[model samples]
Target: MSTPNRVYLARLAGVAVFDPNGDQVGRVRDAVARMRATQRPPEVVGLVAEMPMRRRIFLSINRITSIDPDGVVLGSGTLNLRRFEKRPNELLVLQELLDRRVQLDSGHAGSVVDVAMECSRGGEWALSRVAVREHTGRLTRRGHLHQVDWDRVHGLGAVGDNRGTANLLAVLEDMRPADLANALQDLPDARRNEVAAALDDERLADVLSELPEHDQVEILAALDRQRAADVLEEMEPDDAADLLNELPPPEQDVLLDLMEPDEADPVRQLLRYASGTAGSVMTSEPVILPPDATVAEALARIREPQLSPAVAAQVFVTRAPLTTPTGRYLGMVHFQRLLREPPADLLGGIVVNDIDPLRTSTPLPEITRRMATYDMVSMPVVDRNNRLVGAVTVDDVLDHSLPRDWRDRDAVSPSSATHDGILDGDDE
Candidate 1:
């Protein structure tokens, strides 16, 4: 067999892997490689193949006969049918490296769009170069695609995987949720989902809440069904409700069923309201305390780590049986009011009574105007009986006030002419 000088992994993927005597065995799922310390390319360990019955098995690199644009041909028809288990020293290109963010020595960061493999004189293959593409939005089809030597590009995940590069995930993990969400927005879909999946539930929830509605839908859909429900449960009810609104009824029902009943109930209540109303955008988990509680107690409640800045800025004073939508809406106490007063002073005496609570059905525009007019970071929402049901934080209000299509302004060009060599000429 004539050994090809070079081939692209992206082109190799999905190609039919054939056995000796020209019988098809399976399709190439991924390539495994072990990094090298010297300047030499990382040796191609083997190929992971998906055969009939969706069975994934491994083919040793020693058995590969030829590398060509058509596919990989085996040295022999005999192949192991056992499940493929990843060894600690090996990395799966598709699962761990493809589409990963890589920084070149020139200080420009791009994505590993595809990997280039070359045949050695001794009949072995090694990853030689990586196709680094400047990523754009989902609709943006073409960008600058550079073929850079693998030695010049650093894998950010390698450190986390204890393979190469510095501890990049640790650095990114420290970013604020909004900042992290924005950073993830620029990545390709595969890389974005991989990063999102790596974050912890609470952190992932915070990041998801900060993302645009369309992105929220995409990321949530990418997560495991049970994991998606868990992340939704961690988010504020208002944020969770808004995300759920993006899904079709069938998917929404599936996630809701997976969530704890108590957490799911509030989101359901919010969904019952008109799309752009106070109830629909309000958080069911407001900071509420009985009127008799001391200023000291209120301050402690505000310090809870999970409380958002908007909710922690004040405490609502209510009567007993304090479920969300409490039994009675009495008054409120600003955190400033708590500061000047003695720690032992009961909240009832100094509670501010003049503040008017919003009705559940109050239109979003009115809610916005009221919040602006009163200089309030948050406003209470009440039921028909004047019972406190929830509070609409300023952040949620601001998000709703933006134009519906505001998040979609970044456009992508999908024309094929710009991405040379990335696609097969026959594909057009």
Candidate 2:
């Protein structure tokens, strides 16, 4: 192999993986290592690479002919295509070990910044070195970064707890919220909570909404009550309500009490509606406007960077009081219609109400059928008095429609069943 003797795992992240023909296959997501019961260094086994369509597959160390900052070259193009599942004795270097709090043999306390795997002359690779950053409680002065033998660190044997998340979060900063949430699922319970708590409220809220409900509740429970409530505030009201619904009523009341009343109100309203109803799944904060609002104004509102594509696809035009439960709901104007109309044109003229709006009590199946039939990205939900209460997006419907464990690691992904690639091992 032409690979370097020692390579830091963090630097390998995002490096492209290619076949013998040099065609790009996937990118490195994490490295897999087999752990031992003793203090011996862990053996480097393989890599977890995310292939097309977000399918993560394992590539055995023996299949690689080269490894560098540029890319990892596979000896063969055939990939097993099996979704990577961590064995009980295996550790995911980047996911579980980065930022691990450790105690050096010399009595210095620090956290892991990176781990390096070294290849021996005898043709075996093992985790041999650790880069740790010292822990300094002061904010003004920076801590020293130390490079030491892996055996010198005390905490790598177990998953990290109370570790700094700066290094791990930096690697994940570029990931989309859904991808980040999926990555979070691969981490150990304590490590997941640490990373979740470290994220800013808005980022955490986005990630939380993408996670499975059980994982969402666990991470939330691990946070400080005040912090958790703040994160809930940052999530869409529907998402926030869905997460809260996973908890017991008493616990939900505590978090609700901590949130700002305005943010809590919509969530409370969502909670009152029966499960699987439009009212329970709709977002109370969809783009809303009065019929008199101009096309340009509607365009500008939807253009806000914070709005999701589905929510921004259209605008709900209602009477006085733009907030939910506002005066009579007039109708809605899709962004496409807004673009066709003159900028000065009033939304009232172009507003579309030909398709009747969904009532708060509409069941999930009916809402799904209507949205699909109308080819709508979002549908407005009105109360009995015709007041705009909320709007449900296609994403909401899909989230509810999927099996509860759809996000679990064991869940079968679309491409998981294929095994076009060779998974040859010595035993096989």
Candidate 3:
């Protein structure tokens, strides 16, 4: 038979798969590939399908008889593929990848959507992290087309097997920190701490920030004083301060000592602020530029791969000796504005000082009101000295204060409360 055109899994995103006689099987939910134990092209392991009634099923690649751009051709007739079940000593299917974060070859990052299972050559069923999908569109179209092998999985957590429950604690004992952090989120608090305690300072720090404050406290309390301090020091100052606030004074003091003076000082300052304050939430890590810098220079800095979106968005403009330490606050230039203007224009020319700014101490209500009033995505937080301290975006405020259901529940009312009631009884 002639080989069909090389159709990529990405291009087949919305395509359908059919049986040999051309009966519809299912739509292609996702294509999965597994890394070979030895050096070899990762084999297409299976395809996840969105079946009828919102049900999902996995079809093994071995059952595929042909491939075409239009749809996948399966060798089997229309039959529901059997789901792999976890047996004694077998890895849990769902636990292996469910909710654990993964990096796709395409540079997009996301947690596992679901795992695909199939029976291996020896008549035993196997589970693997086959498909990864991201919620964000950070990676471009070309980047999204690439696929990675399961072996390339840099990190993973102790996920349960196909069974509802398994001994994940034992599996977590040997995993790395980031992987453990990803996995611990789904585990009970007790098991999560057990896995956290085994992580190194850096890994613990990374994982701690990803967890909720309650979990952070639980894990921190379980760690030895020295290890806990080391982890706090490695974390961002704001994050460290947040965690420290949850600890008792004596423990907090000891952890502070473990951090370098430079790292400890800023964190201590942040700790002094109230929770939910801009000062407590903001990172001092921002890009500062002088008003004299050409739009070209600012654009270059923003475009650099090293700078993150948050840092790149608001470019601060200062006075001429571009590096003038005491230059008066000019204004902020947004990326959208910068992109619209010529690169050669001076940043000062584009500066708009009339913008609304927020004080570090501003309450959530006021901050939200200002955001809504100005129709702003983010507002810069500054101190009494007019020095930029942090920023609060609309998302940050809404995450805390926005009503889940703001629509009027009482909008629908009875037409009459008195006379109509009696009239209805008489009208039959």
Go through the candidates in order and give the clash count of each: 5, 1, 7
Give the winner by lDDT: 1 or 2: 2
lDDT per residue for candidate 3 within 1-428, as digits (tens), equals 12233333433444677877887866764455444465433444556554442233556655676665688777643444433222232232333444456666656665554443333454323343345545465555322322345555534433432221222333343443434454565455665666577666776787786555667888888887777778888886666876788788887888898878877877776677676676666554445678778888888888886444655776777544332122455678888898899989998889877975677777777877887887776677767766666566554565446342221111112221211111223210
**Model 2 misses residue 319 by how many Å?**
1.5
TM-score of 1: 0.60
Q: What lDDT does each candidate get?
A: 0.77, 0.89, 0.58
* Per-model TM-score on C-alpha atoms: 0.60, 0.88, 0.52
Ranking by lDDT: 2, 1, 3
Candidate 2 vs 3: which has more lDDT: 2
Question: On a 0 to 100 scale, what is the lDDT of residue 105 in model 2?
Answer: 91
Backbone clash pairs for candidate 2 read: 79-421
Superposed by TM-score, candidate 1 places the C-alpha of residue 255 at a distance from the truth, in angstroms, of 0.7
Q: Which is the leading candidate under TM-score?
A: 2
Winner of 1 and 3 under TM-score: 1
Query: Alpha carbon lDDT of residue 311, candidate 1?
Result: 92
